[model samples]
Target: MNLSANNLCLSVDGVDHLENVTATFQPGRLHTVIGRTMAGKTTLLRVLAGLEKADSGSLTREGTDFLNIPVWRRNTAMVYQQFINYPHLNVFHNVAFPLKRAGLPRQEIQRRVRRSLASVGLADFEKRKPSQLSGGQQQRVAIARALARGTGILLLDEPLANLDYKLREQLRDEFKTLFSDQGDTIVIYTTTEPAEAMMLGDVVLVMHEGRILQTGTPQEVYERPATITVASIINDPPMNIFAGRIVGGQVTVAGFQATHVSAHLSDLPDGAYQFGLRATDVSLASTGVEGEVTFVEISGSETFVHVAVGESPFVVQVEGIHDVALGDLVKLRLRPDRLFAFDEKGTLMQTPSYGLASVEGR
Candidate 1:
């Protein structure tokens, strides 16, 4: 299932919700759609699943334009954040509903329902109603229903959002394995969590303000985000952005010495550029950029030190939880290759210099 969205745009009641979004989802891989609330991530998934029509643009699967395909004929299964199971129906019946709608023989529906429920680790829970199951279990039942429908494409609209941390993690890993084992299934899922994108996505599409900011592998997006918005959305602390300028291949911060990354700087003009560096990319040293620590957040394994470097606040991820107090004097250094530069328009200037060419580009 090679899926493509060409100039996809959508609006509701004359209000623009999604704009000019384009992406290709290859077969047998998980594509995660991530963005802040109202960023059109859900709307994009709806369009792809044929639940909502694009106001403009087209959707295609393997070169066949599917813009006019009816929802039921699209062979797309959509699972929303809310699991829509019938309260009175047992788990078995809920999972069997899709196959039932297919007008399958009773025996066939029973077999498919059992198989689907078993696939989602709910084999023994067939008789339990939605009210009898945990939130995570209900979600699994919902997924099993999609599988029972035999959809070629799966659309998950924040399906894991309602679960607890442990359940969410468990389900996420399960979905990852499900995609790996289910050949030719194309999954497009939406999430607001960057960590989830990093963990589960083969390719993560970052959306903002109704437009796609970037689409690439998790590593590519994390290390070579195509725009400031892309950079900001893919990291835990997000990337630290600073206003600066390039002069003779050297980038000078407002109150720090000049330096440059290994990224190709030839295509850029010789002055005035914005710089982006991730929290993990900044190192601590007394001789580097000076700052006054304003706050610190420790997460057992790492500590995020929020510092006021000149007039701007920047966060640095250090090795372990530190005892550095607020107002402590500190020095920060940018990792050479991790520093990303952008022009005034917020486009990422550095492409990934370390990886093989993208599968899409190939």
Candidate 2:
């Protein structure tokens, strides 16, 4: 089922929650909405699920008006950040509740309950109450419940946010695989984490302050963020931005000149601009731009070195272990092709292109 929202506007008690928000969710695809706290992620999801009404605009499913439909009749299932399960009900009944509500046969309900439970790794705990399960387990039960509902639309509002890091990672993969083959369901997932959005979303919508700033495939948005705000929210460690200027066909910043300029930047008229670089695009080398390593973080599989160059601080993500220590002087090297140039107004200036060469070192 195709879901579309047109010019959705909502406000409560004089505070605007959704402002002209519009988007279409295609059937069988997982759409992700990402934003910070109170950015209207929840409000938009509620509007889509029919839990909250939009003061203006319309929602439709294949030309059928959805706003006029009651919440229970919308045929949508939602899972929130907080675990929602009946403490009085055992795992089996909790997963079976939705099926039973639909008045399915006893054997079919049991079969689906077991299948959904196993999908979320809760098959062996059917007899246990939610109170007896760990927080992650309980959340899985909630997910299982949603899955068993067999709805055409699934709305998830940061459903995995409350789980531990390890479990979140595991469930992320599971959810991706589990939903990939569901060609008839339209899943809308909201997350504060960009990595989660990138991993799960076939289409990502970046939201801020009740507005969607950009919409595209994960790779398109990540590689070519439309504005600084989108870039800031779409990166895990965050993009490093520096004030600089274009001079003599080169970009200059922090007393270092970048010779490998993208051809799309030729029309910028040499002046003030902002430069963006991702941590993964930088590396510590024997000789390059110099910086002082102020902090070091070792995460078993990788290391993140926080370095200070002049008055600006930059982070470099390195694979595995490194010999660098705090307070060590290090040389930083950047891949020019990986750099992004934005105008002083925070709008991305460089057009999408490939195979750009770095001019000989300056």
Candidate 3:
């Protein structure tokens, strides 16, 4: 079955929650929605589950109207950012509640409950209550309960957002295996993380300010971001953008010619362009494009040095800790060959590399 949404619009208090959002979701593929907070990821999921009504839209499942169906009758299950469980019910009962409410036979409920719990690695925790379980286990119970329904559509809205780093990582790894075997199910998972979206998604939808900016496979979205907004959203610290110019086959940025682009990007007309480069592709140099260090962040083994070139911000992500201080004048070596060219209106003009970006996952 395929689920389709066309011209879905919702507004409240003069703010658009969704702006003409349209997409098709096919069964047996996991579609990940990635965006910042208040980007309408939750709203989109709620509308699909028949929990929220759209101001204007058409929702169909296999060519039949889906918006007409009540929330209770829709074959959909949703897990939220918060772990929701019956306070008084143990793990097994929490998973079996929906099955029981559906008036399934006792044997059938027991069989489904057991398998669901096992699928989420909670088979031995059946007798434990949510209060007695850790945060990760509690969320697993919520996931198991959702899986027990065997719904056609499964929506997970940042289900691991609240977990600790280690727990989140652990569960994120387990989720790939758990959901891989789901038959004919349309799974829509939303997150604010680029890594999570890339690692788990069969198709990734990038959203911003209530509109879907771009949609493609992880590699497609990363290597060939459709617009400037998409390139910024899909990167961790965001790709560094600079106003540049190509004159006589030489690319110049901040009054410095970085590379002679006649070979790689030769066909472009001489004019103003926006260039994008990943922080990882930049490095500290003794004599290169100069900038003032504005901020320095040491994250584990990597150090992110934020520098200001003129009025523009540049980030250099390097392995190992560096002796970078604020207000320090630093030189940066921008890999001009890795630059992405964009038009003045923020639309993509060209990508640097098709295969290289995929290997490095920029």
Please list the C-alpha lDDT of all candidates, in the order they appear. Answer: 0.82, 0.88, 0.90
> Which model, 1 or 3, shows the larger TM-score?
3
Poorest stretch of ten by lDDT in candidate 2: 352-361
Worst 10 residues of 1 by lDDT: 353-362
User: For candidate 3, which ten residues in a row score worst on lDDT?
Assistant: 353-362
Q: Is candidate 1 or candidate 2 better by lDDT?
A: 2
Predicted structure 2, TM vs. truth = 0.90
- Every model's TM-score: 0.88, 0.90, 0.96
Measured on C-alpha atoms, candidate 2 has an lDDT of: 0.88
**Best model per TM-score:** 3
Candidate 1 clashes between residue pairs 3 or more apart in a chain or in different chains: none
- For residues 31-128, could you state the per-residue lDDT of candidate 2 as single tens digits? 99999999999999999888899999999997899999999899999999998999999999998988888999999999889988888888899999
lDDT (Cα, 0-100) at 126 in candidate 3: 93
lDDT of 3 by residue, 30-104 (tens): 899999999999999999999899999899997788989999988999999999999899999999999999999
* Candidates, ranked, lDDT: 3, 2, 1
Count of clashes in candidate 1 = 0
